[model samples]
Target: MNVEPLVPVTEQDIQRYEEDGVVCLRGMFDSDWIERMRAAIERNLANAGTLAIEYAEGKSPGRFLGDMFMWTRDEDFRAFVFDSPAARIAQKIMRSQKVNFFYDHLFVKEPGTLVPTPWHQDQPYWPVQGSQICSVWLALDRVSRESSGMEYVKGSHKWGKWYKPRGFDGKDRYPEAQGETIPDIDQDRAKYGFLNGDMEPGDCLIHQAMTIHGSGGNVTNHTRRRALATRWTGDDATYDTRPGTFQKIREPGLRTGDPMDCEMFPRIAT
Candidate 1:
């Protein structure tokens, strides 16, 4: 099937993204695409079944589902990522002649869930080097402040510091930080700080791998915040599984500083 071509990203959008480390594009997807993705998610939930973690206990049968990397596992998702405009946008933003797929993460936050994602940077958790990676967070639902959407620290990507990883339960697992508070700031709620991401269905926000970001717990009733995040990197990106790093398990074959040109990270655009 011939999908509509992606609209060229505007210079204004690129400028804003560079300034704030994130930019939200509204209605980037058509209604038909959104519906198709929603349906695909529903199918994945039904067939794969939901993994009930401590945080997602007592929720709907399929309130939280994730990790749909092998697009062949779901036809609709494959079409959305390949046939849709997201890949082109990612290619343009990285300012590279080519862009490759890293992975796809589906975050489904059910209503009234108190499991907040801890403040973290994707770079520290990734098994790759360089700043060529970015995540395209596309909301599958109407996301609002009440629905616990993403919040990013302004220009945090340029800080060049990779902090220790924390659990999704918001606990610092590193022994050194024991009994100490996580010093990261929630730019959304901070006084005189910047919190610049709230998106609707078909609207997506892109952020650098090093950008500090996290989300609050869902406090609203019956608000489902589902996001489809597709990670991409430039041709220069490489695989690196640092020893003693949890990220190593995700990309086992990758060695430190090795070019990330494996089939898993296929070049989608050029």
Candidate 2:
């Protein structure tokens, strides 16, 4: 279906991202990119990576899934990283002179999946550090709040707090790195303002790594919620291969405080 090709990022988009810490880019990805990623998602599912994890299993009525570093094994994902406008958009939003590829993540929730992604921040789980990191979450299917759409706490990035990282099942990502526990947004939605949008296949959400966000379970009877989040870091983001790293794909041999260079975090845009 020939979606309108992704247009150049507008000034307002950057403003929204900076102010709200999360922005929805309507039709930010072309149909070709969407199709390629959909295919790549299927391939990744068929051959799960070492970091792939399933949140729903035996006796579970639905599928709550996860995977990482797909670009290493999938050509389509590689193309999306190097050929798509993701890096360009990231560079503009981050207001950075250069952009680097961080990694990729895939999350799928089949119909009837009842597991909600716990509210959490992204940076605390990672070995990298900086405010220039961001994620472009692309939807392969139409998504709304009820369909497990990602919900963000507006301006949570400015909170200046590093919350604990927890698994989809609510376990801590690192036992010793436990900082503050994330508030239960679902329990008190009114206390903390949230932003969620209905997104089409070609649409995507760009959010800061420090932004607190997560998705609910898929309640639809037939629709599947499949999403791919390509993370990128800018000039300010640096390597910190400390212990308790989250989703450590290939260790880019850089010492702590070093710039995120090397093949693992290749400079994608300048």
Candidate 3:
């Protein structure tokens, strides 16, 4: 894996990220990183972490598997983190002078998994603040809307609201979460515009932390939908170590509103 920065980040790409709150980049990651992430995800699935979750088992014909922060436990994940284009992409999307590692996330939909991920913002669930935070999700398999392709509300990050977090298991990830409930964008699809596209291996979707986004399940009977997400924070992102959020684990010595650069969330780009 090679973490080469995207040389000459395009002005148009930056403009789209600023206006739409999300953008999709293609061919930024090569086959090496893609293969490494696939291997790592398979290994993580074999030995799932204590926090790993499986949904739609028995209730449906497929399973939705999710896990996070495997970089601490897997060599391939670590290599990808420190050796992939994620950090560079994050830096460019955020338009920041520096970027820090946040965490790694894995999502899998085997087939016929119909559960839709609830619409919500990512920043409210995390222990962080500031607009310079985002996640880059890479599709390891060919993904379409019917095959659990992630969708984002165009320019939702500029809404300046924090909605309560929702879970994929049809439960509140934060039961006692405070804030406005996300509107039924999917219900009133015409009222709110959406952005989604087919993605292949090495293609990545960069979304603002405050952007409202979610995905449906794999409707196909045989194809698999595999996606890996790497989250990052820019120069201004800081910790908000408050309790009762959707976040499960906490890093040491990071008090409320401290700069988010530590061993757990190391500075990745500058």
Candidate 4:
């Protein structure tokens, strides 16, 4: 499938992303593309036996695992990531000769679910080191501030603080050092205004790796907040696993500090 080229990211958009740590782009995908991805997600959700199943008794599959990347096993998800307009936008934002696919995550929040993602930076959770990494948060459904959509801190990416990682269900898991307070956006919601990503099907929000972001719970009935997040790093990115964390690099031909040259993380345009 040949996806059309995205409009070149303007100087203003790049500056905005750098300054605010998040930027919104509309019409990145059309209705047809949205439907294709929606169907792809449905297919993966229906076939429980296809991918690695992490089932919890007496709970829906959505509640148990929260659907990590199915692209590694599902063909439809693979096509969506490898052969879609999403990859093009990722390359444009980073302004690198090539953009490497870090990974894909599928976050599905079922209705009335109170699981909140704690305030943290994506860089801390990642196994790589670099400031070039960014995430494209494509919402497959209508997202609002009340429905626990993404909330980011404006210009927090420049803080340069190493935060602790917590469970996605909003439990603290980080060992606090002396004089270190756990990242909490809820404490001062007024000072750090919520950068609510109120997005439609074709709209997408791009954020930096160090940006402080998290979401609330899904309270509405039958509202599915499905997001396809594709992470990318610049050609100068490197792989340095954390002490206790184990990251499985799916793509081959990647060295520790080498530029991303694998096919899975392709140079879509440049």
> lDDT of candidate 2 vs native?
0.85
Model 2 alpha-carbon drift over 4 Å, by segment:
1-5
What is the per-residue lDDT of model 2 for residues 53-154, given as tens digits with 9 covering 90 to 100?
888775367988899888888888888888888788788889999999999989999999988887888888888988899998888999988889999999
Runs in model 3 deviating more than 4 A are: 5-8
- What is the per-residue lDDT of model 3 for residues 1-270, given as tens digits with 9 covering 90 to 100? 556644445889889989999999987887888887888788888888877778676567778988888888888888778878888888988889999998988899887898777688888788887889999898899999899899999999999888877666766567766778788887799888799999988888899998899888789887789899999999898888765475544554788889988899989744
lDDT of each residue in 2-25, candidate 1, tens digit only? 253244578888777777778787
Candidate 3 structure, TM-score to reference: 0.95
User: Please, what is the TM-score per model?
Assistant: 0.84, 0.95, 0.95, 0.84
- Residues 90-192 of candidate 4: C-alpha lDDT, one tens digit per residue: 7767776677777777766666666666577777766677778899888889888766688888899898777666545443433332113445568767777
